[model samples]
Target: MKYRRVKPWLVAGGCLLMSACSLAANLNYRALLVGVSGYPGLDAKLQLEGPRNDVTRMRGVLLQRGVPAQNIAVLADGVPGAELPTRANILGQLDRLASTAKPNDYIVLHMAGHGSQQPVSPGSPFARDEPDGLFEIFLPRDVGAWQNLPGGKGGAVQNAIFDHEIRAAVDRMTATGAFVWGIFDSCHSATLVRSAGGSEEVRMRQVSPQDLGVPATAMDRATPRAPAGTVATAATAVAPSSGAGSVAANRGGSAFFYAAQTSEPTPEMRLPAGHPKRTSHGLFSFVMMQALEGGAGMSYRQLSQYVLTRYGGMNETRVTPLFSGTALDSAVMGQDAATVRQWKLTDAKELTVGAGALADLEEGAVLAILPTPISGLSEAIGYVQVSRAELATARIEPVDYAGIPKKTDTELKVGTVGRLVQQAMKFSLSVGVDLQQCTRPCAFDAPLTRLRNAKPGEGVAGAQVQWVAPGQAADVRLTAIGDRLWLMPPTLGGQQACTLRPMALKAACDDQMERSLVSITLGSLASPGNAAQTIGRALHAASRAANLMRIASALASSPTNGQVKTSVAITSKGGRRTAYVAGQVPRLEDGDKLLVTLENTGRVSVDVTALYLDSRYGITAMFPRGLGASNRLESAASDSFELEIHDDTLGLERLAVIAVEAEKQSERADFSYLAQPSLPSETVTRGGNEADGNALFRDAGFAEYATRGGRPAAVSARTGMQVFSWQVVR
Candidate 1:
């Protein structure tokens, strides 16, 4: 049952999986585990550790999750009575699953083996489907070397399962209304350039396309191509295959979890890290099994995060796994974690992220850039600020340039993920003025000169802040009328008009309440104000407000989320208490109060901060109310906070708990500075400040709220937030 040197624990492709349950009569749970560790056609250098042990591990996890022994199927080279994992048998099992699976049945398909790619000839019918003209494939035990087609149509690898064909088979099962989970512990190829290190004996699950007969030139031209030889090293066979769970996915009734991105190779390393006889297994599979064995219900998003955390904890930072599905929030049988929206970084020079409007990223928003997903914010190469934003994509430019080496940006490989530090308002306001007061000989030179010479101090709106000469992409146009400076919401010289409905208050509007674009007067310059102060102050407030909003939107999106427990209870005026319904919004009447309990469930101690954000533009730090107080909750400890309901502050109100892993007892990460007095709903003035200047200005520049020195210091552990929001209706 055991062998030495974990070979490429390859499968025909990724498997389709289903969770086991006690209700066998109502829901049928089935699985097909194909693990191949041998490739006679390839050199001994390419053989992987036998996956017999891998299959056993998988089988054990299923049994723990309640799958019946009779329902599980196995196809491997070494397992007795198991059918050989030839391409035919793998497809046959899929066909059986599609044909026999009922509407309510759930299935799990797992494949472990070597994977590579082959080029599709331009003349092949499937050539157009592959952007790089290469078909990602998983080699079966019987897979042969790639050979050119007789007619020169293209090249083909015998016994390799193409990824698209696997997708089609899964589609059939899903169409039957059965939920399918495709869990592959292998990567498509090694497109990543990894010099990152870890301690465990690592075995890669990728075979180079070149070894499979892919033309060297075609491999070079591929969008995400592998090098000459794979990063794989032959290892002796050690194991076998592996879970139950409500993971949501993009395709209806299906979800896919890849051990590595299309660009990287996943590893088969000794799992459970320090086990006395730690067996070698695909790192992704073992960690995932650990999550599923916990028996908590999770969404696909949650499962993806749990696996990622294991990688980080184990110091395996090279491979970046991936997940996709529409209902990532739906519950499945497993654990959950925070959701950080990361996009693939395609270009370092162009500084582009593959996310935009859909992800709510705005121009000028800053992001923490990491060399790998496992890198924490403290390990960021530097920070990037968005330069342009479109519907589904955005472009980024670097800041904190000194954080990285001179040519580091150019060397950053593709697929790096960018993390948001704070949000920028949808569109920054650019001031354009002719300033009739100054001659061409002086066209708005006085105000422009002041702004140009301003320092990059705290609360600066944006570095890209522009004061135009007359035309261009201007958000606000200022004119000198009499002794006063008048601000007009118009496109100077009929150029780019302000896209925001209410140029100055767009960022302040909570909803789609139509507020007309309004202009403002900087008061008479002769009295007390100057063009520089009025324009400059407004810019800072707008920028700050945007940052606060973006941070608020992502308060609970950290990987550290789900580590802490948050529970809510409501107390009636009569002293009776009731558990808060999961998704039911409470309509709080007078005297109704909500109590929140926080429990530290993660590995390390964490400092917790309870924050409240109301319908109006207000953020209040509710816990550790004093500046010097600490809210550190050690592992297994709990903390509680009570919130009073306000009749006037009606609409959607939120209670969020932020927990940052403590690196040292004295370390603290306080965001209390984010707390600001709520702005009155009636104010829509320019310079949208979230502070108590009597009335916080809208659209841009906010009056300084507090002395600004307290931002959290970088820590080795992650910062996590857990939020509970509900409607406050009369």
Candidate 2:
């Protein structure tokens, strides 16, 4: 095999560490980067601009993180004297890397190019096995060589590399106890393309089976049934070939991060405003690079979430990224002690760490405090609990172990090292909806369903979970239903106590919007495995409570006009009136009259609009509907709007009062690209009837309107709009 090695350079940047320990003494790090930007094939559409740039960018990241100069290898499309990324050359390098790898070593294989699918041969060992009855193939530089090859011919399979071939090599590396990390910045299907920035072209990054000369009969025979919940992409279907068991057996784990879902196309676009370059990059590759630039400790889960957040912010929601393998919770970059950074104590009881939510830090996360310049695998002196967390900083309070001192004997200074010792344990809880609460057609004892966790950066797809109860255990299959995983329980009837348990629940914000709070009784039978039943119950309950608390916090912290107090009044025709104050509203009944009153200070003209989201996730614009009339209330005037609580408005209802300055209303209109006269009519109603509202929410340009905290942005920089939300329990 022919190849060329690129020596890593000492880039001037902060050390990118994954945790608070020194590099492992015995572990070795190696990388194989293949990028094909110039494909000299019959299909001119295969040429891309991102792959070459992606390799350059990733090489820089690895070097900055201190990978040895001699350990990195590269294969680009057009570099003079460099090895070309042909099928043979690429597979040769993969095998070479696997042979060279040893136990406790780290191997990174990054491929950026076109990905396609080919029909499986009839009666073959791999036939009709994958959810999509086609084998996913990566197009090498010589992909066109097999275009005319006859099917059932001996040489046709050699044209492109199949996923099983890649898996086989990965298996070899893992069998040697080496961790194999694969990053594919390509997509395998083009049937569904969601593009941003008004691009007209749908970039699929795939070639159809017909283009590769696969026989129609073979395809027809292998025409795979769209398995009940199978996503459209072959990437998701082919991931399990190198299952978790293979990865777990290796002390060092393996993982794959795909650029897009199987059915969606991954887009390559020029760098956004903040990046220094104007060159294009795969959306996933660009975001992944940014997530790693922090030089702080992060797990695969944390890193994935970080990327998902930034990617969503870009308004590219068509293709959801996919991550599979056994090490979702393992530290990203590598597992060496040197990859972890040391944090410094800020006070006697609290230490300030340079890792927070972005790094997957959560409340109650335990961290080990090690002295600076950790010499070896030294035992931690004491532990700390994360009391407060921000995007990039966390405040930790020292934990007093039975024998360990609360304070370190040596005065802790800034830059002292700390490592995440234990993650806060969480539980997957299953609760039954009260039989009386079911609307109709409800099963006797089905698990209560909440809002699907479909938002970006939330639940994983196809993950397995188990439901356990006294004398009964049923396996649950999870399918991606919309944006979240839908839990499918076995068809068992009758009310029985049960608790849901996954092998692991990656620490993430459970922001599922639900109608009513599902009460979970953590009985003794609800506990599973080694976790204490009481603790499991408490954690599950706390998680649900946290969701409610988050909503309340959003309202309490909303930007307001001075210290004004708002009140709501319920009145009857008999002239009897009951007043309900903001933050203390009583349970509302159907047909109850609602009079919302607020004092408008003389500071600015306040325009108020009432927004409602019902139990079915149907959002409606409740007020200010007529045309040619301003929703604005005069300064220094007390204004009131009358609304009735509709009888059908049952379950959890959310009401948001949006107040914007009348003077900046034009700016708001311009930002949303809607004319001033059409503003009031653009209100969203149930069942997606309001096209304007749907467009506003769907556009990434207006993503800032939705806050990361799961609330609408209370303050708009461009238009000075302030929003306040309240929950109306009916």
Candidate 3:
């Protein structure tokens, strides 16, 4: 026999794990996890350690989701009882599944490993079929080095699993009326970079074509030009086998989740940054699992939003994750569960939940004790704050609030569950220094020490600063590349410093207007006298930006989010309001005016507050000018607020409107007190008691202000906030 076909019942865990059904059990759910870590054919620097972790965690997540251990087949290096992720085993399993799939069978294929680009293989049918003259590939453990083809006209890697091959197998499965969801956590657009910057542990999931013998010009021809925030002449890593991911998205029976766009890099780092037990794992994998576990009952699009928003909140504008598929509305199965992760309410001595670090819940995160898994926010008997959190369980304590004073242990019905409400927020920022270029006497040492040792009580310290090794999980990195220093958002690895190019300074003060649009260089900040202040100002900007996103992300989960009816628009030059739409970027002209209307759609009257997040990381409170009918829109009534836009900074900006249930007609939830201004420059430094939790504090902002002693304010879950992003153009 020329080939061996894996029997689903024998090797792939088909009917062996279950009794034979009357006729092919309905929805024969199956999964194939391919995680490649060892690459004998590549350089040692190219080897990785995260794929093993990714596979292990993924298996556990699937098990929790109810996928029988036998139905799931794992192919990873170093994982016991699993076959090696060689090209032959991967294809054999795919063929095995495709050949046996029945109509409506749900299948999942997750590939986590190193990906690269190669010229079309010689003597292969795909040779002339590849219009781009290259195949985007996922490297198997047995993948071979690139070698010269027969005519020397091109080159290709031996044993590299090509895109078209993946498409063919997936197509066969889809043709059988099965639905496939493909997830790729690896990137192929590798811009080879110097390893001198950042911590040494973090690794990008890309292997540059240049690393092979491909010439730069040929490599350029092999891939198209990259869009914004990416280097030119890159392969289509974003597509992850356009045939594969798109099959799930465009085909009638599939969906795909991409870790990054074409030409952009994705990083793998130690997860749960502050956790001592944290080990190497792909950030995308960890993030994906956290989102999936949080609520496996949602649609594909909803799941995508959670990953995107949470990622943006942590790493602004670094890389983007894309989800495409016609099956967006399809519900994911944690084995038929469409509800948030929940634990049955009990009379145990301590309230312990089955969810822990795996669900991304931290110690300070808050949860709602609901009457049932599908219970609404109003049905919450009381709230609980996570007291102790571990991998699989957490201890909860009832929190005191005005409406419900204490934890209600008796009034709950049988089968009640604890629902996730809000994740705990830590207002500290971590910064890392990349000194790959210079020696000990370098100029960055002094400033690094100062910022690394920065305090967190008040003023600039309000945004706490943490120093970490380069390449470790960090919010920002100060990298010294030879003679030039660069300020960059966290990059995946070495060459990703490509994003470190000159960044146009945010719209500055009138005195700095001449320099407003000018691109700033980090090299100028390397001098001794200026290093400290420069680092301080930069950190200040980063802190404010991160906090603003925190407000947008955390409060976005307000139990009342979708329940509150609101409209956001801006009056244009012609005096007509251009209503802002979701999923599209809105733009505002210099003279444009923002118009917001709030309708009390819920059971009780709501206090409305509007905030503006600027490109400079400054936040301004726009509503509740102070105490009146306008302050609290009546339960059945509506109100409007407007703010004029001027010729200020122009870039990405956000608008957040929050409505919190107000039991009384007199008291207002003045969240405007959380308003924080841009550093050393513009914004309102106005009203509200600083020491009080209601207002934004001097340095301790949203997280610290809302949760004074690990307990959040009472109105937290009762509140609904919606944030919008628009481009402020001239």
Candidate 4:
């Protein structure tokens, strides 16, 4: 069944006349913020402590961004003097905003509360189209009062706002050529919250269908169905537009940012009373409000990352935020096209961005330089790397100008202003595993498990092995010795000619008899394949997940940037020897001293922190106490400092050095909190400092940074920061 789209309500003749007169006026900025923390007449289990506070914080951010007080509307539950956020009041306000908006106007609709899903009644208008037999809904303050009403009637659904309703309102606004931004800080699932360690009391804001009078039979009958004209797949969903047109097709387009994925839960937290920033807020709202401070010239993508990095830093991994919109790269907070200005090129190669450490600029970030008068059609002149970054400005060195038009007179010169564009970075690994020798009756399964269970400095941990094969995409794990990689026990079923390639000439290998590199294909194992191949793929998936977890942990703990010169010294009994070559991976014995020389060109005080991820995938803080001295380096005119590595470090280890400018002398407490060591094998540590660090670096913001191996951007302050990664093998 095709549902008819709702039409916008007609304004009175006088109102239309007034609108026409104001068509040429400055673009109006309007916002409708609905935050519900109290559910009257409902179970206390449904109560929240964040929504009321979320609205106040958001309103403050908007006001600070230059939005007039009269242009914003607020409806909150349990807040005196504020409009009540009942179903009727919320829907009425949406309609009013849609009908009154004009071309070039900006409308922001932010909803912070619980979201629920209910079964669509049989024969209901939405049933045939909603293959899942459910309606996504926002629960208003009076939702409890309407729970007892019979299904299939308007009155029964009156208290909850449906997704279609929101889509319709957004559509109407977009039809008038206005831009719309919708932020929903709620989720439909309760299982999406990551429980704090040792705390069973944590809860997500969600309600079941039964709690809202949805019959089990109705929900049971709501079986999944393949929609007409579309192939059904586990990864694909086919549904009618919830209400708005495609993000790109609508005038000026619209964007929707949800605090959590559709299946995940959004969380609210109460900070300790003496916390400096806030007391209670949805985690999303808290991070978002903090992101807005000193975030004047950020694109929607940067804004999203600001929230993501901080959210991840909090050690909350149950739900990832989602963003969908046409203007993802556009400035946030509704800055008009005329108001968008480009950063000026101070030197032939350097583009000076007024934003620095506070804006999240890190060394080695790549940014696209776009021609002035920026728009969707603006052409990029070239790309540049952030060679030097500071608190308020960064020096960008030109990487290339191949994108510039050859016939044009444009030259790399001072005072040329251009917009900078950042691209998202993704990491992936490619390797081939030899499977030629394995036959039908191979009996090597025991050895495979032994390889899998190997510890750091033993067996195959941290070995690089290559494979040569043709036409096969199967995954396999192999152990390397000398120049050849041996296939681990339990040869895969498929027959293919494969050979292991020798290690690259410059690459160094350990003295161990057996070294291995694991390879796994990412896809379904249901296809008829050998048991060994399927098992190998599963192992690969698990390893990949573990690697990502480690990456997140490293990001939460590591500092951003500081310049350093490093060398490895082998203090063997034969004699004290130095392996002091810049940029070379050095091999070492059991008792080697890793010498690091630090330099601070900037005047700001900095903290030097180093972390090592060992061959066994274990992480250890190697600097500060780990290395037996304070790693904090103060600013000096001729500053030169040295750090000595401990003797216990082993295996193929990756060392990351981060230097961050001090925010305040007291902020050292925050670093100490993050530096507290976790179990060597533990991938994630839950603590308040992680969340606090998330907020700190997110507020600092980073440049459009990418690394060759897909390492995550190191977290750091925007000013006077640098990061160096080195490998030391023992």
Give the CA lDDT, 0 to 100, for residue 428 in model 2: 25
CA shift at 95, candidate 1, in angstroms? 1.2
Q: Which ranking of candidates, highest lDDT first?
A: 3, 1, 2, 4
- After superposing candidate 2 on the true structure, give the runs of residues whose Cα lies further than 4 Å from its correct spot: 1-25, 79-81, 145-158, 194-204, 213-218, 225-251, 273-277, 335-730
Return the TM-score for candidate 3, rounded to 2 decimals: 0.73
Question: Of the candidates shown, which would achieve the greatest lDDT relative to the real structure?
Answer: 3
TM-score of each: 0.44, 0.47, 0.73, 0.46
lDDT of 3 at 463: 56
Better of 2 and 4 by lDDT: 2
lDDT of 4 by residue, 1-730 (tens): 0112211121222221101111112456689999988887568776877888888767765664446778889999766667999998999999999888787687888899987666555466655445544666788988863343355443344477877677667777877878777888887533212221111123355665555666555555553442533311111111114444544336656666777644455767653111223256777776676555433344565566556555423324334566666566655654322222135556534456554433344455555565543333246666665666664467776764346433222354454443434312222222233333443232333334444444532322222112223322212234222222232211111221121011221132222211212222212222212323333332333233233332333242122332333333444444576654322224454545555555555566666655544433334555566434566666652222333443243333345445566677545311222322211211111220111223223212222233444333433334222222222333
Q: For residues 1-730, could you state the per-residue lDDT of candidate 3 as single tens digits?
A: 0112222112122221111111123455689999998998888888889998898888876665445688789999999999999999999999998898776677888989988777554455754445545567888999887766667666767788887778778777877777778888887554323233366556778777765555555555444422333332222332224443544433436767777654456777877766666788888888888765554345575566556556656744445566765566556541233334456554466667776776667686666777655567798888777787777677777776437777654554435677665566656677777776644456567656765665554333345677775457677666654444455556533223332111121222222222112112335324433455555655665676676565555654455665566777878877987775443345566888877777777677777887776655567888776534356776678777787776566545666777778875456676666566543331111221123242235344355335545343323567666766665655
Which lDDT tens digits does candidate 1 get at residues 505-567? 233232211111112243222222144544555444333433343333333235566678878
**Clash count per candidate:** 66, 15, 14, 11
Local accuracy of candidate 2 as per-residue lDDT tens digits, 34-110: 88887776466556777887887788667756677577788887654457888889899999987877876888889
- Model 3 lDDT vs. the true structure? 0.62
Model 1, global lDDT: 0.55
